[model samples]
Target: MTTTTTTSDHADDPHLIGPFAIVPKQDCTHLADHDYTLPASAKRVDGHQPPCTDCDAIRENWVCLEQNCSQVGCSRYQQKHMLAHHQNTGHNICLSLSDHSVYCYGCESYIDSPKLVQLNRQLVEASN
Candidate 1:
């Protein structure tokens, strides 16, 4: 009696697997070795901004040091409470100069004096 063994018998054969089949397994190792550095387009450092004291309690969009409402229509304008409200409402507080003084009307806080001039300058330059 003769028995026939078909290719299906060796279907699990490692040698039969093509390069494409093995490519995905290598991806993890490649990713492990990868530096994952920021892109060149991200080379420019962000300009200095005041730190949020209540960042732990705030969300990303609403983060601000000023306690004023960053929202345009909202009546609440107190700096500390506004920061909390802004965090809750997902509003971005404006941080810019007004009447030759650096202030964020939205957050209702003054920026650091050292950075205030530079920030105003940047705004002025951008407007031109």
Candidate 2:
């Protein structure tokens, strides 16, 4: 199936910017068929399907979830949208389908931080 993005970038130098640079792409296989509720954040989707927070359009709004929105009071908070990892935080483990989202491990954009694996191992050891 062909992957179509619902977002784009406006650049005067169109040749300098590639389509991939702004395309809100996602691996549909990992996406839930229906919209799911995120009670903790209280972000709701009016669309038939919950928007893929990582790369799909939500309702009629299209945003790039690849990184946390840098806009002040953009509605998407830094804790939810930013993927900048810390040793204290194992991963940007966003289970939300709104605000901040992530790609599946198999997806090309997935971040496989060495820190995440190390943290997981530590957790296992502590539990054991």
- Residues forming the 10-long window of minimal summed lDDT in candidate 1: 22-31
For model 1, how does the per-residue alpha-carbon lDDT over 1-128 read when each residue is reduced to its tens digit? 99986666667854334432221121121122222222121111243222233332122122222233222221233235434555566543333211222334443343333323444465465447
TM-score of each: 0.23, 0.23
Q: 1-128, model 2: which lDDT tens digit per residue?
A: 99765335345533234554533333334333333322322234453334434444343222222233211111134333223221123222233233233333224343323323433353345336
Instruction: Candidate 1: list runs displaced more than 4 Å.
Output: 1-112
The per-model lDDT (C-alpha) reads 0.33, 0.32
